[model samples]
Target: MKDAAFGALLAIQFLTRLPVPLACPWTPATRRWAARAYPLVGLLVGTLVAIAGSLLQGLLPPPLLALALLSLWVALTGGLHLDGLMDLADALGSNTPLERRWAIMKDAQVGSFAVLALVFHLAWKGALLWALLAAGASPWWLVPVIVLGRLGAVGLLVAVPAARGEGLAHAWQQSLTRRDLVLAAVIPLALSAWVPGGAWLALGLAAFIIVYGLAVRRAFGGINGDIVGAAIEGGELWLLLIAWSWWSFAMA
Candidate 1:
């Protein structure tokens, strides 16, 4: 029980900007168990963002409210996934061999491709949120989308072969067992019981997980931390797109 509690804290500590009052142990076993709690971290982030959006829904214009929500989203995660997205974008856009592309991803300096990807990513998120707000959709829609994003991350961690022999992803992968995946999946499974169109959403997420994992494998020969982070951001965007499209279809 104590180790599990500390594992949760370790996950929260590593994944978010939120300060954990308790010190989580820095150990391999702890990090391994920590992955199981990743979905819960997403739930926490999503719930807080939803509540904030609900409170601010009518007070601010849709545009500004969307901006505020987006800001909060980025602030909470400290742009960790965004940085990975940027790094991957730089690597992909470098038009070099895989080895050189990997090197570019390691570079500290941001490139034009990274800048462009950042703008597009932020713009799409803000635009989609603003549209949803204007349509009077419940901000609670964010809960599943955000939760699924991290679930996607966890899914990737286990599914993709670790490209490198080192780093956090590899260590977590090495420690993972099927039981660990079973535990990690429990959150989403419970969440599906309540989320609308849950079955369909699960199907979509599964497909994304499979395709995204393979794409990473083919492009980079396997997965790493950056690829997993990219999966999160990409998964979130896909969910948002689905929401917006569904709304449009219903209205049309």
Candidate 2:
């Protein structure tokens, strides 16, 4: 459990750029638990964003508040996932073959497609979050959704093959055993029980996993860090959009 906790914290540090100190030592054994640990990082990221959004609620206008929280959320993770989303977008927009697309992603320079994709993603996220706030969904609800989305991404890492020859995805490609999935599944499942209508949230997460798995299989030929990152962003954005839409309709 301690090792798992440390792995979780390490993941949080990796994902969010958090300044927490290392509580446990790193080891080869730690790598085995990486899949389980990754989502906990999302949990922390979501919690922080919700807190920021909640605090900013009274001070800023709805759109600005959402944008502020969204910026903080991306900055926390160093926009790591967003970067993936942009690269993937650029690759997809290209007319080249798969190998060529992968090569393009490796290029350090951002292309026009990447720039436009980043703008759209950030704009979409900002608008979605702003709508959620205006709809009066509790900030508490947002945190679990974030956790679910990230956990869903990790699940994808376990379920899919690596698209490239080597990278972070390759490291954990087959390393995630059954025990790892169990541990990864349990934490979020337990947390979901605590939120209002949380079971439905879990159901939504399941749907996301299914859809993401199919998409990854068809699109990337396998899962990579970029796809996982895109999955995380997609999960979060979709959940917020769902919540906002549901709440708005309920009020109407």
Candidate 3:
């Protein structure tokens, strides 16, 4: 019980900007267990964001509300996934050898590719959120979307070979088991079912996970922390796109 409590703290610490006051010893064993709690962390993030979205629903214009929500979303996660998405874009856009691509991702400075990718990603996400909210989709849709995103990360961490023999991805890769994979997949699918027209959302997320894992394997030789991060961001966008489109069709 105590271990589970600490694992939850580790998950929150690793996944969000929230200041968790629990101090626990770090070990490979601990990290592996903490990985199991990733979906719960996504739930917390989504719930908070959904609550905020609900509160701001009619208080501001859709564009302004979306921008505010987007800012809050980034602030909550400390832009961790966004940074990963940018790093992955920079590495993929660079027509260099694998080692050099890895180095590019490690560099702190943002490149033109990263900048372009970030702009497009943020713009698309903001527009999608705005459209969905304006169309009267429930704000709680975020819960499934965010959970699916984290599950994507967990799926890759368990299934894909590590790009290199180091970093957070590699560490999780070393520790992930078959049971971990099953639990990760099952929880997200089950949670997704609670939303309207969620079966399609689940299908989209599953497809994204499969495609993303394979693409990461082909593109960068295997998955890394950046790629895992990219998977989360990419999965979220895919879910939102699919969900928004479905909602639009139903409304029409």
Candidate 4:
């Protein structure tokens, strides 16, 4: 029980701007439980955002509310995953050799591709969120997609070989094992039974796994922390797009 509690705290500490009054010791057990707690971390993020969005929905217009929510999301995460997305984008956009690309990923500076990617990524998310709000969708509707998005990271981290010998991605890969996946997947599976269009969302997540997993393996030699973060952001967008696509079709 204590392990699980600390695992949850460690996850929050790593993934969000949540304050933990105690220092979490990193160990094999923490890693195992942390991997298992991935979905819960996402759930905590989603629920907080959802509740805040719900409360503010009526007080502001859709566009303003969407921006506020988006801003809050960034604040909560400290743009951790988005930074990974931009780093991966810079590496891919450079169109350089493997060695050069790896160097770019390691470089602390942002490049043109990173800027472009961040712009487009934010635009897309904001637009879709505005659309969702304008369409009278409840903020609660996003919970499952958020869960699946973070869960996607766990899948990639487990399935893909670490691209480099050092840094956050490789270290995370060191801790997680195949057995950790059992607990990681439990929440999203249960959510499938609760959220409308959820079973299909599960299929959507599977597709994300196959597509990004293979893409990273082929393009970058394997996955890293940036790739996992990129996967989380991309996974969320993909899941959101899926939900909207199906909903539009249903209305049509």
Question: What's every prediction's RMSD, in angstroms?
Answer: 1.5, 2.2, 1.3, 1.2
Question: What's the TM for model 4?
Answer: 0.96
lDDT of 2 by residue, 47-71 (tens): 8888887788889998888878878
Cα lDDT tens digits, model 4, 156-190, are: 88888897798777888888887788779989989
Look at candidate 2 and give me any clashing residue pairs: none
Clash totals in order = 0, 0, 0, 0
- Report the poorest 10 consecutive residues by lDDT, candidate 1: 243-252
Which candidate leads in lDDT?
4
Error of 4 at 56 (Å): 1.1
**Candidate 3 C-alpha lDDT tens digits along 80-119:** 9899999999988998998899899999989999999999
How accurate locally is residue 115 in candidate 3, as Cα lDDT from 0 to 100?
95
- In the range 1-252, model 1's lDDT, one tens digit per residue, is 777788889988878999999977877678767888888998999999999999998899999999999999999999999999999999999989999988998898999999999999999999998887787677888888888788888888877888889877897787777677779878887786687655555667888999988887888888888888878888888888777666666655
lDDT of candidate 4 vs native?
Answer: 0.87
- Model 3 TM-score? 0.96
What are the lDDT figures for the candidates, one per model?
A: 0.85, 0.77, 0.85, 0.87
Clashing pairs in 1: none
Instruction: Provide TM-scores for the models.
Output: 0.95, 0.90, 0.96, 0.96
Best by TM-score: 4
Among all windows of ten consecutive residues in candidate 3, which has the lowest summed lDDT?
A: 24-33
CA deviation > 4 Å runs, candidate 2: 20-28
Tell me how far the alpha carbon of residue 81 in candidate 4 is from the true structure, in angstroms, after superposition.
0.4
